[model samples]
Target: MREEKLSVDIENIVKKWEGKKGSLIMILHDIQNLYGYVPRATSLQLSNYLEVPLARIYEVITFYHFFKLEPPGKHLIQVCMGTACYLKGASDLLHELRDILGVREGTTTKDGLFRLEVVRCLGCCGLAPVVKVDSKVYSKVTKDRVADILSEYEQEAAVK
Candidate 1:
């Protein structure tokens, strides 16, 4: 909910790459890991500090899906739509989530607590229907379990 709070410590992020241009990508990777997304302000600051061109910074950030330009929701829900997952009722699960959250895929709720997305695969073929909430993975997902999963998020939001 606090977009301003989601920022990378510019000094620290750049200091890690001292003396090496090759460390650029690795440094940005760490920055993304810390901020969830790369804010333009942070990118500009990085460019100024690292002596790297702003265009190059923007290029790398845009090329990587992990480096979002905007701050993400408090919780990111990724539903697997891989062949195995789809055949195992992943679409149905997606619908249930949309209905429950009152939002379509690739959107965040008004409260910013949840964001929904359909991914190609989560590399969990064995767990055909897989859903990942933030960093946690839920396997063997079913319609009946959707409410339980969402309720858990609701509770977490309420607590926050």
Candidate 2:
């Protein structure tokens, strides 16, 4: 329902993928990479640019677990829940994060500082119970270390 003009970057994205097989997903991935999510305004432009139905655009976005509809927080926190991580107390780390952030998994905090998510695996089973913030991986995490991990981001935000 919003009127939007495509950004130069997105225009190029559409032009690059137009009429190509499997273009929709590729276009969507680029959009997500650009904005951290598949935004409504951008979707409108993409729909018009590709002569693709808005519903079809939404179907692909909603079907992919990786696609996000809203803006993500400044920081992304992922707790690994692979079999090894789970066995090594990944649940504890997740619960601690949820308590400290005051938001459940898959939701952003009110301040927009952090977005917490439970992931199936990080593939470092040898380093089970891992927590990743942004790109830094904290291996062998415990419930007690959650605050210190969060504090690093909070402090970084304060400095900037």
Candidate 3:
């Protein structure tokens, strides 16, 4: 649910990557950062600006897991599944999330409040079972704590 379409103005972005090797990916990264996703219209504009084929732009976007084709939810919940976290009950945390949010991994909730993703590591193994909500990292998370974590964001969104 984003309401805005692709942006038509990308002159600055194009110029920054001008003449650089693999500028397409760099340009796409900036576009995603600006809009949270790569809009089809914007991609077309980029194609015309760079004189690169539309297919090539899409190829790069599709190839990278970090690039998104659609707008993301308000909050991104990343559960670290690193060795320590897994051993400490990351699987249970994932299951708890599925039950509470009614969404599968790598998907956003129906209300667009939260998106769940499982990351390989967050570099916080000492605090196993880490659940990162946007920029905030919840260390030593438990299956039971999942509800509390989500409710915090939900409440914050409601207040705003």
Candidate 4:
């Protein structure tokens, strides 16, 4: 029953792009946008519906950094690794986060509350060693503040 709904949803998405040039990427983008990440099942349905091979779907998904194969955590921790940030000890920040959260980059925590990731820049060099939790940016972050920052989120989660 659920599979049928997914098939219809994917079909509607594909119908909008059918017979169009350069539609695969656009279609994948829409799928990712809808699902937060592209489920393997939906990708297979897309392959059959579009007459495109499964390998081709994966090729594009893997090629694009924006596309995610897994659902993101409730709080996405993006640590800036730009030149200024790195020089300001972003690597140490990253390490501390991994140690504290018990999760590496591109992975969510066991509780699904946090996901760690590294980005080249957040465009806030003056605020080097920055970390962004969802839409909120924490600037000039240090290892000492890691626990406090995490605790704030934990508190919020507890309240919710």
Candidate 5:
């Protein structure tokens, strides 16, 4: 079953958009912010509330990276593989993360603790070799540091 909190959140968004024409996009954005990904329930609910077709809702959800159909991991690891980062062994870092998480790029680990992604750039060229773990940024990454960096998250997960 889906969490009640998510249902409550969707209800709130629907209420906020009541009688407000052209609020579909805003409501969807708020919904995505509340939940890391846009669950199927939310999409259907939004469609019903906005009088929008499910196809349109699905289109928007798939078009944007911010809206995910599936649940995301606790930690979203984005490795910047831009020209600068690539020159600085960003690919190696990506491989190390995949090895540690046992998931390939653009996929979440089975444990759901981590998702590995390769992005074009994180706009931290000066700090080439950048990676974003959830909202935190790590620069100057090294192959040796991968285990250490991931170990910290593993320890946190253990405590949880």
Candidate 6:
């Protein structure tokens, strides 16, 4: 039933962008926004519906950084790697997070609690060594604070 709904949604999106130039990217963006990641099955369905090849779909998906082949975790941890942040020990914070979460950058935790990523900047240069979890930003982050910050999220999950 869910698959059917997804197919319908994809079809609607395709229809909405049909006959337009540069529609494939737009269609794929809609799919990604809807499902968090593009499922292989959905891409296959899109290939058939749009009369485009599966290889072409995969090419587009892989070419774009915004697209994800796998689903992300509940919380996204973005460590800033800008010059300001890097100079302020952001690398240590990232390493500490990997140790505490047991997941490398671009991968989610086994418990599906966090996904770690490194971004060039978060636009808060004044707050160097910044770490953002979901929508909340932690400034002046330190390696020692990694455990405490994660504990806060773990506690929230437990309460829920």
lDDT of 2: 0.88
lDDT of 5 by residue, 83-148 (tens): 999999999998888887888887788888888888998888999899889888988988998888
Encode model 3's per-residue lDDT on 36-151: one tens digit a residue. Answer: 88888898877776778889999999999989886788899998988999999999999999899999887888898988889998998998989999999999988788899899
What pairs collide in candidate 1?
A: none
State candidate 3's TM-score: 0.82
TM-score of every model versus the real structure: 0.73, 0.86, 0.82, 0.89, 0.81, 0.89
Local distance difference test, each candidate: 0.83, 0.88, 0.86, 0.89, 0.82, 0.88
Name the weakest run of 10 consecutive residues (lDDT summed) in model 3.
1-10
Candidate 2 lDDT, 14-122, residue by residue in tens: 8787768878999999889988988898888878767778999999999889999878999999999999999999998888888888999888898989999988889
Error of 5 at 114 (Å): 1.1
Ranked by lDDT, the better of candidates 2 and 4 is 4
Better of 2 and 5 by TM-score: 2
Q: RMSD per prediction, one decimal?
A: 5.3, 2.6, 4.6, 2.8, 4.0, 3.1
Task: Give the residue spans of candidate 3 off by over 4 A.
Answer: 1-8, 18-22
Off by over 4 Å in 1: 1-8, 99-107, 123-127, 135-140, 143-145
Q: Find the candidate with the highest lDDT and give its number.
A: 4
The lowest-lDDT stretch of 10 consecutive residues in candidate 1 is: 1-10
TM-score order, best first, reads 4, 6, 2, 3, 5, 1
Q: 98-139, model 1: which lDDT tens digit per residue?
A: 999999986778887888989999998999899999899999
